[model samples]
Target chain A: MAEENLKGLMLPVVIGKLLAPLPLFPLQFILSRMVRGIAQRRPEFFARLGSHIDSSYAIDVTELPFVLLLKPNPRNPELTAHRRPDKVASDASIAGPFMELFKVLDGRGDSDAMFFSGNLKVSGNTEAAVCLRYALDDLEGSVIEDLLHMGGPALMPAHLLLQRLRRLEMQA
Target chain B: MNTQAITPNAKPELVCPAGTPAALRAAVDSGADAVYCGLANETNARNFAGLNFTPDLLEQGIAYARGRGTKVLLAVNSFATAPRTQLWFDAVDTAARLGVDAVIVADIGVASYAAEHHPQLRLHLSVQAGASSPEAIRYYCSEFNVKRVVLPRILTVTEIAAIHREIPCEIEAFVFGNIGMMSEGRCSLTNYVTGTSTNMDGVCSPANAVHYMDLPDGSKTAGLGDFEIDCFAAGEHAGYPTICKGRYLSPVRKEPYYAFEEPVSLNLSSLLPDLIAAGVTALKIEGRQRSRSYVQAVVSAYRRAVDDIAAGRWHDLSGLVALTEGGKETQGAFQTKKWR
Candidate 1:
């Protein structure tokens, strides 16, 4: 009963409160940096992704205020934020709740199930979506950990806070 | 029961898994009679990223396997969704064009397409087709001109012999690797949890829906989507978050138990002779998701075992236990009916 109550009350309230005031541009910039850092750390990942996906992809965190537009440039791969969500037209767009997107990026969740259950939505080019799925599936480690490592001492608190929130959500 | 032992003259073919080109080479070099692989798309079941062969890799792998007197079977086994049937059709066309020994397929439509368009290309019914009975087998053989049927890992040696006696096609049985309890191609548990259909998408309990969290008391919880699948104690090796193998608390049972199937591998080394005598033409080892070293080790062990069985030698296969899933192995449903 307590668990049920917590589930009904805590999740939406917490997620809304945490994500509401987050500056979209700054967050998107940080995420772009994180992607760049990931590419630096694991060049093979980006290379494989580029080889498979030659188009632009928009990754929208459905619950969040930002969208990450990535172009798999084999020569120069980069992830950028769309200033206006409506402005950037991608070959493919994958939209899902923030945590679900994180789970996929971190190689921790099953994209198929999330997509099947309607938590994750894919639109436009199916081939691009498949390529992205394959690329993400091929990844071996945690995207969150890599981001935290890149953040260094400054983002340790944020990492801890995120962990705590995840724990709480799981408990609920 | 046929008490007569299989003669030393008859040797069943050893079909091995090749997820990559290197693994295909390793399998062929290690004494595999035939190696099976899929393309880097949803055409095959093991469609994990970085795994499976690309078109170029498949061509190279086929060349390598064929040069060494080994046959290569292409798995275009995933069910074709209504709108996306072209993918399956294209895969068949490619396999036929490349001259693979056989095209293993599951969906009826895909099988029909292969049979109609490419009569020269031999068709094998994938286990995902779930054609266990003689009637189903006959239908596939007659309709699709299926030369062989990869039997699901649910039949006993006796049942297999019975099916073999009744059916016109050669029988291929899984001899080792992760054992699935659910009816092949019919399971939707993973689909319920994750939006992807295993039959259509060619992936089950895909990595994206899997998450592991460290608990406060040093325990680890593995979750699939929102539900906690299993919680392991410290020092325990947590298996992948596949829904069928997960332990759960049932309404009838107070404590958590393996409600569906336990996480154990199927190692039929001891029953190689029995299977051969039962008219099993080929022995398949599962795991395209496994590493190359794993493919080498398992294939080598099974090769020696098959040879020993053919040579009328008593083979001890206990060494393979260490290489099995969770370091545990079972004969599965080959010996007994009460395998649940």
Candidate 2:
């Protein structure tokens, strides 16, 4: 194959692969940050949303080894925008009094960020870790962004953009 | 402008959890103004073994409590599904028929139904409802006419004060027992593993699936299905393994860590005055599955605390530490948000 022809094909293919995640990347980024902001600033909203979580019967998150628990403050439930932290834990290592102690000590006993920093530990399962992380990421990004945008300009777009970048990484 | 004429008693009511008929009587007799309990079925959050009141027993329990000037709050505080909606509905109806003071509900559908159909019945929002903010509380109050809210185990005294300032309904907060770190209304940990959701089914770590094995190391391992929730060393109290309270291994650190939470009780005895100042109406004790003796002891201690506070007396509640999970207790979200 000629060098010119090969280069053209490779560029398009590479561009196709690279740009594929672009739209979603920006969206995910914005969404994730929006979730962060909401998690940090507007916990009451998160708590309210959590209270209304779909209760369909399924698997138990407690059984998983790694759990990334994230919810807005229960006292104030206002769906807001921004990136929020998570409460990350391994199921095997931390479960009861330890998790409670960590929560009370972190000064964010109710904040979702405690789970992400490994203050709370899960013990046995690894898939739980991944799923919990992804679930939290998704909640921060997709749920907050969508809900805020639908709700009103009470949400900041530029703020969400920065948050998106912080939450989601561009594919290398 | 007779501001003092209202004279509202802001003294926090000791809300005790009654897992059985006997526990109910113990709580009521021990100076508990309000006693909360769930049904025998998985419709309540504490769906543990050898706990909760049957419909017949609930009637007797309510009568017993009411006759003693104690209020009975029936906790139907769990999720209801399409298939199980009837059970929850029936529970509510039965609670109303049994002359209970209020029915604690978490589900939107259930709340709406109770509000609409049982216009005369009083509805209290469950912590499982997770209605934490002023707006959310207001929404429930306006929409469903919910009279009181069992606030989640998350909130500083200042935060509670702020919320109390804005909301109109009565506020109840947990003062002792299992401090659920997860958002009460939205958590789905139970359903994710055992195919049963606490939010919907009102059960966490359902009994049939929970198993315990005494390991050779003098530590007992508790499991749900094939998953190991926790391993307790001998001489240390081993709580039944629930997913939220399970132990886990962290990749960042090789040591096993409590991923979700530990078995710690939130004892806010030191903050009783602060809670009273916050205009709280009730202080809840979280143990419906506890023994009657446990109920009596905890309730009596809390009752004394409430009276002492009201009488302008100050005493340390640290003496009750042995009653807490792992023989430890913390202020929960009442202090700073230092959740480590």
Most accurate candidate by lDDT: 1
Q: Note the DockQ of each predicted structure.
A: 0.04, 0.01
lDDT of 2 by residue, B261-310 (tens): 87778888888777777778888998776555567778999988777777
lDDT of each: 0.79, 0.65
Q: Looking at candidate 2, what is the lDDT of residue B127?
A: 91
lDDT of 2 by residue, A1-172 (tens): 2654444334434533554444444544554455465556534223222323221111112322222233323333122222222333323222332223322322213212232222333334422332232223212223434445544675577356435432222210
Which tens-of-lDDT digit does each residue in B1-340 have in candidate 1?
2234356556788999987675788799999999999987898888765567777778988999999999999999999988999999999999998899999999999999999999999999999999999999999999989999999888999999999999998999999998985588899988899888788889887755666666677566778877789977765656766899888988998888988888888998888888998899999999877655567788999998887777666777788786676667999899887876
Task: Quote the true-contact fraction of every model.
Answer: 0.03, 0.00
| Interface root-mean-square deviation (Å) of every model | 10.8, 18.0
lDDT of 2 at B326: 71
